[model samples]
Target: MFKKLSIGRDGADAQARGAGAEQRALDYLRRQGLRLVARNYRVARGPSARGGEVDLILWARDGTLVFVEVRARERDAHGGAAASVTRAKQRKVIFAATCFLRALAEIPPCRFDVVAIDGDRVEWLQGAFDVPAEH
Candidate 1:
């Protein structure tokens, strides 16, 4: 689940903040033993596509493909970082994952993960949400 962060409407700033958070999450995950495969993976399925971007894609030590959604909040005024991952966001990640796998030789086991950062603290949620269907 996402923490429903309160982000500004300013797209560029939001992206900068998102990139920073993703870097933090990536570093932390690397320390935890996940191998970085892709960062900021995006694919467009066109006009009616549910496609979007995936913050970080990691390969678990045991071969699981990890799709991570990175969230961060400067303050907990809204609901913290985990509160931001809405169903729509999850769907977008899923769609992007599908596009990524289409180029793979074989699809492996995978899970959706959330890395929530509040203030200076970071919390990693494994299997935060089930991998959504491509359709």
Candidate 2:
């Protein structure tokens, strides 16, 4: 399933860039045949806990539910886009994915993916991260 996304018209430059990167990643995924399920999925843990957000969720052709994180950088230096997804970031995305799964009637095979945008390059990294053992 697909839905219209209102992105890139925001007031903040960082937000705008993030939205643009998300749009680019979404387009790339679509071209690769992954159908979008949700966008910007978030879970608020309140003052007591760390909250989480996932940039995009999609349904793969193989029936896998994909949770994606989009990262962007002007250059691929100091580890660049993909490297920006640190351990804490992985925890946040995993937390958000857990919340997303709770709403499903039947959970399918799932994996975390990352779309690392370094300048004009877009790299699709499937199984980019996993739920940490403690989670």
| CA lDDT scores, all candidates in order | 0.90, 0.95
| Alpha-carbon runs more than 4 Å astray in model 2 | 1-11
Q: What is candidate 1's lDDT per residue for 1-135, written digit by digit as tens?
A: 889887657888888988899999999999999999999999877888556889999999999999999999999767899988998898888888888999999999988999999989999999988764556
Model 2 earns a TM-score of 0.89
The 10 consecutive residues of candidate 1 with the worst lDDT sum are 126-135
Per-residue CA lDDT of model 2 for 11-34, tens digit only, reads: 688888999999999999999999
The regions of model 1 sitting more than 4 angstroms off are 1-10, 132-134
lDDT of 1: 0.90
Q: Which candidate is the best by lDDT?
A: 2
Provide TM-scores for the models: 0.86, 0.89
